[model samples]
Target: MYRDLTIGEKGKDVAQLQKGLRSLGWPTGADPSGTFGSGTAAAVRRMYAAMGYAAPLTASAVTPSANAASDAAGVGEGGEQPGSDIEMGRSSATPQPTEPESTVMLPVSEAVFVPSLPARVVSVPVQVGDTVKGPVITLARGDMTLTGFLDPSEQRLIRTGMKAEILAEATGVHTTATVDSVGAVVTPGSGADKTASDSSAVTPQNGSAYVPVKIKSSGRWDKKYADQDVRITITAAATSGAVTAVPEAAVSAGADARTTVTVVLTLNA
Candidate 1:
């Protein structure tokens, strides 16, 4: 039911055309003046181009043969190529059917403004301004596993099948997971140790190196939080089950070759 109108034409239809273009993110400049002017025509071409209905218009882009079609279509210069079915000067009451344009869809590179090709983002590769081949985004496909660092001492308390609580800070959602694997203790040097005279002078705050822990998330999570931080808490042992315990630093070998605690346990109640 669409009728084609061209430049210098005045009607409410022209105003409606301008309004539609504005809604589609194409600004028709300062006026929606009820006349098909150059501005409205240019916006129409952009709309057509975005929808892949026509080749994009550019000052130096359209060929001479294409220009002739553009002129006849009543679309501004550089507009979509007119179809072969359109009659140039027919004044019949019944509208003529037109063949769809036969032009190939413009390449996404010409239509899309992204610096990289459309792709699933896996991880950031090149930094800003770095040149890349196809696909700006990295692609990844798999079930998600949680990776985190745990104190070497804490790692010893965890084993496969241990339940973990993962809290998403953004949504305040708590998700349950199970320990997948606890890697061997890794004594990664603290940053300050790299520049310190004595590497031992800079030690981890916990007095122990860290170990890698992998957990499998058991609940669904929004992909928006992919590669983001989450709080992981694992309950490996119950304190209520312990009848006696001593801090690591408090126990030492005595003259009798027995471990002695700084303070003796006394049950008063």
Candidate 2:
């Protein structure tokens, strides 16, 4: 009997196993190759089902029968040849051929992961019939929040609850948002934090430090704007009524540590 070929095994033997499965009308999900991955394993399961195996097969390895090559040559169980379904008036005394030991391919159970909450697919790096080596897809959960980084001077002027205007230059979509929070700690400008949306007008060229800020849209945001760079204008301070103005020369500080503005009154008699 040939040695068992299991998952994660590579090389010519795996390739041969893939070919054998294809001959049995099973799709391996990839071109016949040396790697025995999930796709190959799934194909093996399909082969088992076609062979009338009961549910919950125990073995995960493929054990080639001593006459594996002959079986792959179109000779099936009970000495039945491929495409010769006509049982021409055979004699009743004819003895039936015993099933071959090597033709049986066993399947092992594999675990599947499922997410609890619904999510949006951000990206897929691999396609059908392609060999999967690493990450296959990216997912985004819940509503998207915007994050941005600010330089030291800019951080000092920003505060939570301030109104901000978000502009996407490419689409010219304008949306109103509010400052949800301001990060307490400072981080290097080069390492822009990703926990929030990045809305910087221009990235720092000299690698200066920056503070993280979180912003939330006033309403549901458009899905098309996700991951796109945007410009943000924040209203740090504002005034509603009239205010007094003074020249720099008329203002002074007294010894009492109080600010005084000199008023010059001219009377014409």
Best by lDDT: 2
Report the C-alpha lDDT of model 2 over 7-109, residue by residue, as the tens digit.
5667776676677667668867864497777677788778667778642323343444545444444333456664444233232223435543232233322
**Model 2, residue 222: C-alpha shift (Å):** 1.7
Give the TM-scores of the predictions, in the order they appear.
0.40, 0.41
What's model 2's lDDT at 191? 44
Point out where model 2 deviates above 4 Å.
Answer: 1-118, 127-129, 189-206, 239-269
The count of residue-pair clashes in candidate 2 stands at 4
Worst 10 residues of 2 by lDDT: 108-117
Report the alpha-carbon TM-score of model 1 versus the true structure: 0.40
The local lDDT score (0 to 100) that residue 241 gets in candidate 1 is 69
Tens-place lDDT per residue, model 1, 1-269, is 13445555677666766776686798777655777666776786787877887744332222236445445555323443555433432222234455443322222343222223222356656677988865665454444446656876676788999998888797677778888888766564655334422221223455556666777866544565566577889987776564876789898998889987798669999
TM-score of 2: 0.41
